[model samples]
Target: MRNLITFFILNLLCQSLTVNADELTVTLLGTGTPIPSIERFGSSTLIEHKGKYFLFDVGRGATIRLSQIGMYPSDIDNIFLTHLHSDHITGFDDFWITGGIWQRANTLNVYGPDGTKSFVEHTQGAFSLDAFYREKQSSLNLKGLEVNVTEIKEGLIYDEDGLKVSAFRVDHGAVEHAYGYRIDSDRHSVLISGDTTYSENLIANSQELDLLIHEVSVIEPKLLQSNPKLKSISKYHTSLQQLHKLVEKVKPQKTVLNHLLLIGSDETELSHLLETKFQDKNIDVGHDLMTIHLR
Candidate 1:
């Protein structure tokens, strides 16, 4: 009887682990460019694991985009900013406003690089007048809502409840200091290369990751012909060929190309080019609202 009880306990523990392992899901919220599009927003990605929601890079329209997917701003437990670029942080104000209006009881945690605290303070200051008026008119006090800002460094930024998140510095040119994030749970890991140029560090850090989501730009002849300035900027971003090489080296289980530039072209050819370079790995082109289950 004692042996049978021990056996059943071990089996139940194994089943619980398996169920928790399959709970991580990544959702691509806004897989578009700085320039607005009818189909896509800017550059936000939502990660859900073990009943917790984390938002990375809340670009323009991210709050509304979340609403479209049946998630409120309050649903986000943590917000990780890759950089302070306008395209990346523009929707932060909207997130603040929506969370305040809804009167969420929980405090929101915002994490980012060096200037994160000042940025949040400035944003809060900008909303001060509006917050005052809302407080006067309604039962909810907007200004009373807490927004905790933590300035992050290189190593592990967050670790709790079997989930660990780390940040690595990435090259995004002189505009701002940028970072790529890696999130690891017990059974799966994901890497997000947030608007970076091709970096050896990212490739090394992302090796054997379950999912690698990196930005990609197109350098086809027609794009170069249309806009010379855009062509120059594309050099600072990751090109299809560069991404192909990175995938070849890191060899992640799946490679997702996102933050697409020069889209509406032959995406299949681009995927095929990447696949030929990194054989035996799944290559996917990201679209807004696309969800991938991480097992």
Candidate 2:
């Protein structure tokens, strides 16, 4: 009996070892903001690990971009939302109704910070007519149209099969409970800083992570001077200077900028500015559809 138990343990260890050799891929499905852009879409990210697909923040055009990446809306069952911001969740209806169209039979599991339940409930309520129409007029499975919303706090919200996700609080101006997420798999770990000002909580949670994807905005004095509203907005989002300090503290292997607000400079210029600040560190200005693989 003891020999059999030892053999089972060995087999499990070997399986784990083999799994570690596989790569986890992160695809930036959309890297733009609320502002419309032909070159970029709103904020959505897809993390594919061990054949499982997890999505974070379904912004505008998320499902369309997912289709572009060879994934149907029905392929994703688990979605984590950082906040209830319009830009972050505008694509919810698209994903929901479209997935229904594609015969998604599984319940959509959505996780988010406090107020998420109300947000989703209201959203579903708003889509009641469309949902009812689809159900009556089409053969789509309305069961998958059902969303299971889970409001999360600053802790481990999900853990299964060596994949874990933790949520932490972030300051988004007056928004009380915005969140950032840390995703840990068997081999790689990543943190996504969903629209936030520099938070010590984020740095503490993101220590030595494989990748840190943080939001950043251009901080030009003239632009801020000209647009008082943008200046106010800047207070809620991280400036390049603030990002430099945050990156200096957290020190992830690679840092990618997302939710870019290009008020002063273009993408290349913004990337150049970031590179100059963190000369020794690896930095990439995120763009839509950019895929990074972690092995």
Best by TM-score: 2
lDDT of 1 by residue, 16-100 (tens): 8887765779998888878788677888999998888999999888998888889888878699998888788888999988888
Pairs that collide in candidate 2 are none
Error of 2 at 184 (Å): 0.6
lDDT of 2: 0.88
The lDDT leader among the candidates is 2
lDDT of 2 by residue, 1-295 (tens): 9999999999999887787655678999989999998778888999887777899999999998998888988898899999988889899888877887888868889999888888878878988888888778885567877889898878999887678989999889988989999999877899999999988888889877999999998867898999889889999999888999998888899998899988867878886786677888798888899999987
Q: List, in order, the clash count of every candidate structure.
A: 0, 0
RMSD of each: 2.8, 4.2
The TM-score of predicted model 2 comes to 0.91
